[model samples]
Target: MKPKQTLSWKPFVLSAAVLLILFPFVYLVLLSLASEWRFPDLLPSYFGLRNWATILGSEAGLLESFVSSLLISLSVAMVSTTSGFLISRAVFYHPKKNTLTLLAYFPYILAPVVFAACLSFFFLKMGLFGNITGVIVAQFIIAFPYALLFFSSFWNKKVKSYEDLVATLGGNRWQTYIKVLFPLAKGLLLICFFQTFLISWFEYGLTSIIGIGKVQTLTIKVFLFIKEANYYYGALSCCLLIFPPIVLLYFNKRYVFKKLV
Candidate 1:
């Protein structure tokens, strides 16, 4: 019965961890909908949809920023993941792998703020400062490390023998990747896409510094609202900003959780 007892503990621990992670998000939702949130109070005295309504109706640039954020995130995710996948594949095929492997993960070792600062100077020199393209480039750099790490694991484990098998069947390299390797790596690719998306969406320092007044994103707007003491509006805007990733997470939970387990 030791195995049975150990299994029982697993559910209990997992439930506790889930609740711990979700509690702040639940509170954030409550605060977003609340008419007023006072610190001394355990909970809001009144809750209404007024906050959501006001932001959605009155805010002019919020939707634009939301779209910009979505576009930037999607673009960064696609470019970084694709580049990382290709690089990882090349590394996998390389006769000497260590140097390429090190290069792939090098960006991740740098602090994000430091990297952003370096990029800011480069952008200024290139006259790309305060531009959407500049922000996208920075995000691509940030997201590539995560994509490389994730795809490398999938490629090594699932596709190590793929080339040999494809050669035996008289298939070329491209055909092998397209038919055998890619299908097996789909789950990891999805995971990388969403991971990179989140990183780009929530990125504040880089976006603010690089984009300046030109390319506004949801995170920048949220920070600006807070600085202006528009807590309600900020909270409401945040709720809208949070919805996309939450929906993605919900839809991908089965696959993501299975991998976690």
Candidate 2:
């Protein structure tokens, strides 16, 4: 008889790693479905769709908050990615490119809470305080510079050479971008959109300070539940919060990273 083969540790290690990564998400889902789960109970007294169903009723404004977060994130990502890509091009050609790039890092120097507070006065003066638009603008100020910096690498001597070649071939700036640059930068654009969307999506500090408890995005709702020690509802809110990022990650892996690979 052949000697029994020793099993590889790699598979077990991999499985453990996978479990570690998935445990939080799985526990969150379980918690969301649990009711009256408390100490020494081994498991919840009840588990089902009861907690999730609360979103449909007015017991929780979860659905509304979810919609609000989705809209705000989408808006911030679109505007930031587009403007960043365009402005990065101008920065690449500017004599003060270094200075401009440095300035892009300004918003990041201060803590997000302090940054929001600094902007609060302007927001109040502009009649933007405690509203959705104010939160968007505030988040934009942070997200846009990030986008500008992110796309900086997309423009360089090679890209400039391509632009010149297009110009020589009778392609105008619009045509050059439409036909050459956008195609070249499509991957980066999608990635930046995803990044900026996440920035706005999970943003708590700025949204809280700027909105002043009015524009309650999903993140805020999660905090509110947790603050009240409503763990069951908080878990439910957490599940809702994690849903979009999970969807976005799936698509990013399937469509974006797959193509890049």
Candidate 3:
């Protein structure tokens, strides 16, 4: 007879964790639509669409800030993902994989504030201060590690066999990568793109310090509003800021779960 599987606590544990994670998101949605939110109420006194309308209809450059964030984030995602893929590919195929992997992971291990401070000096000396290009460069640096780490792991495991098989079939390295390796890595690449996008989108300190006041992102806008006690509007801004990542994840839900599992 086949052995019976034991009933495990894993399902209960996972269900609890899922609910814990989702509780905040459910609360945020509630708060965003709340018309009369107050502390000690345990919930909003009233609920309406006014908060969403006020933000979506406002001329406070709210839309521009959204557009700016999208543009910067997409730019950072594309550049970092592409650059990281190339760098990780080089490192993976190098004779000294451990050494190169260490180099790739170093940036990610550093403190963000410390890294931003170091980058600030470089931007100042290079006359790149207070510019979008400077901000993009900084975001790229910060996002590269995430892309590299994800792609590197996927490339090593999923594409290694195909890579060697292609080599044995007389295909050159470049052709093999384009036709074989890249296709297998596409899902992970998409995941990295979304990850890098979120990193750039929510990043505040580096963008603020590096871009000064000339460049404004959604995170910076939210921070400013909060400082000025614009609670309702700030909540709206925070809701808008979270939409992109939510959308990205929604579309990539299958791939995300596959990777996680």
Q: Which lDDT value does model 3 have at 137?
A: 88
Lowest summed lDDT across 10 adjacent residues in model 1 is found at 1-10
Candidate 2's residue-wise lDDT over 171-192, tens digit each?
A: 9989999999999999889988
Is candidate 2 or 3 superior in TM-score? 2
| lDDT by residue for model 3 (54-90), tens | 5566555678788888899999999999888878887
List candidate 2 stretches off by more than 4 Å: 1-7, 254-261
**For residues 112-209, could you state the per-residue lDDT of candidate 1 as single tens digits?**
76788877888899887899998998888878877776665565643667778889989998898799877877887788788888889988887888
Candidate 3: C-alpha RMSD to true structure equals 4.7
- Residues forming the 10-long window of minimal summed lDDT in candidate 2: 252-261
* TM-score, per-candidate, Cα-based: 0.81, 0.92, 0.79
Off by over 4 Å in 3: 1-23, 34-48, 54-58, 155-174, 257-261
For all the candidates, what are their Cα RMSDs to the real structure? 4.5, 2.6, 4.7
Best by lDDT: 2
TM-score of 1: 0.81
Worst 10 residues of 3 by lDDT: 150-159
Residue-pair clash count for candidate 2: 0
